[model samples]
Each structure stands twice: as C-alpha cells, then as structure tokens.
Target: MPVALEIVSPEKLLLSRNVEMVVIPASEGEMGVLPNHAPMIVLLRGGTIAIHEGGKVTDRLYVSGGFAEITPERCTVLADEAVPTSELSRAEGERRLSAAEAEYNATDKNDVPSLDAAMDRMQSARAMIEAAAA
Candidate 1:
C-alpha cells in the first residue's frame, strides 16, 4: 500500500504525493513512516529525509527544526526550514559550518543551547552536500 506524504515549507510546498516509505530525522533519531503507520507527533532535528516511492527513491530533503504529524493514512511535516537535497552546495555547506563554529566559539556557556542548535544545522547541511556529491 502506498503512503501519502506532504512536505510543506512556509514559502512553498516541497512535496505532496504518495510514496511507499519515508525515513525522517526525528529529534531522537531516524524515524520511518509507512502506510498505516501509527498516529504520532515528532519533533524533527536538522538532518535528511529520504523518500521512497514507486520502486525507487526519488527525493531527499534537508530539514531543520520542525514537527511531523503522522496518521494512519498520511504524514505531514511542517518545518521551520526545509531545502531539497539538490539545493545544497559543498562550498556553501562548508561556509555555513565555519560560521557556525565561529559563532559557537565566540559565545558564552549560557548560549550553548543556541550554539549547539546552529552546529546541528551546519552539520546537517554538510551531510546533505556530501550525500549529493557521492
């Protein structure tokens, strides 16, 4: 049975269709959703989402802080920021990683949470770039 997935961004709809499976990056770790998946909600941490469809995996996305709402029939992701894997650039990813490191090093311990968040974003961006380049 096919599973429906809708990936939406504030500016646009990234994807909306039926798929066989979806592997998302949840705050705890990777979470897989399929047709008739149990209803639940998950907080997404920055990472990749692999979409499996029609005997092939056609899409990969970089997702930032967000929440995923799942139901028996469909899964919907509402993200703070989401970019298609194709949008990632190696140079840009490295630049972002450097900036995040700089910001983290320049901040105080009290700001560790925020710095860590930025680091996660940078790491996720890097991973996406690496995945695309492979």
Candidate 2:
C-alpha cells in the first residue's frame, strides 16, 4: 500500500500524492516513513524531502522548518517554506547561500536567533543546490 503524502506551506499546498516512501529531515535526524508506519509528529529541519515510488525516487523538495505528522496511512507536512527542487534554479540557490553566509558572518556570535536563521537559510540553499544537481 502507498502512503498519502501532503506537503503544504502557509501560502499553498505544494504536493499531494501517494508515495511508496518518504525521507524527511527531522530535527533529531533523518527519518524514513513507509506505509503502515507508527504515528508520530516530528519537527522538520532545513533539508530535502525525498519521495520514493516503485523503489525509485520520484521527487525531491527543499523544505525549511516545519512539522510533520505521520500515521499509518498518511503523512502531512506543514512547512514554514517549501520549494520544489525542480523549480529552484542553481543561480538562485547560489545567491541565497551567499547572502546567508554574509549575514551570518556579520552577525554577533552571541546572537543565537540570527545565527540559527542564517544557518537555516544556508542549509536550505545548499539542499536545493544539491537536489538540483541530482
């Protein structure tokens, strides 16, 4: 049986499909969810969401922060921001990475919130770039 996966952002629903498996970037680490998986809610980090079907990866999405609810039949992702890897341009990713690095460098080392936000942006950009390359 395939699992129903939905990825939504504040602005729109980015994806709604049935996937054989999904790999999410959980705050604790990476998590792979399959059909009939145990129910849980996890905090997502900035990274790629790999969608698998028929033992092959069908899609990759870059998600920056969010929460995911997984159950036996479905997985729902409420993302702070979600961008399809196919839509993210290499140049755009590079620009975002550079900007984030610059901001991180300029911020005070003691500024935890600013540093975290900058790091998140950098990670998201890098994930997007990597996804694009693959």
Best by TM-score: 2
What does candidate 2's lDDT look like per residue over 2-24, in tens digits? 99999999999989999999999
Q: Ten consecutive residues with minimal summed lDDT in candidate 2?
A: 125-134
Top-scoring candidate (lDDT): 2
Residue-level lDDT tens digits of model 1 in 21-51: 9999898999999889999999987778899
CA lDDT of each prediction against the hidden true structure = 0.82, 0.90
Superposed Cα deviation of residue 11, candidate 2 (Å): 1.8
| lDDT, residue 57, model 1 | 74
lDDT of 1 at 41: 96
Candidate 2 ranges beyond 4 A from true positions: none
TM-score, prediction 1 = 0.86
How high is each candidate's TM-score? Answer: 0.86, 0.88
Q: What does candidate 2 score in Cα RMSD to the true structure?
A: 1.6
lDDT of 2 at 117: 88
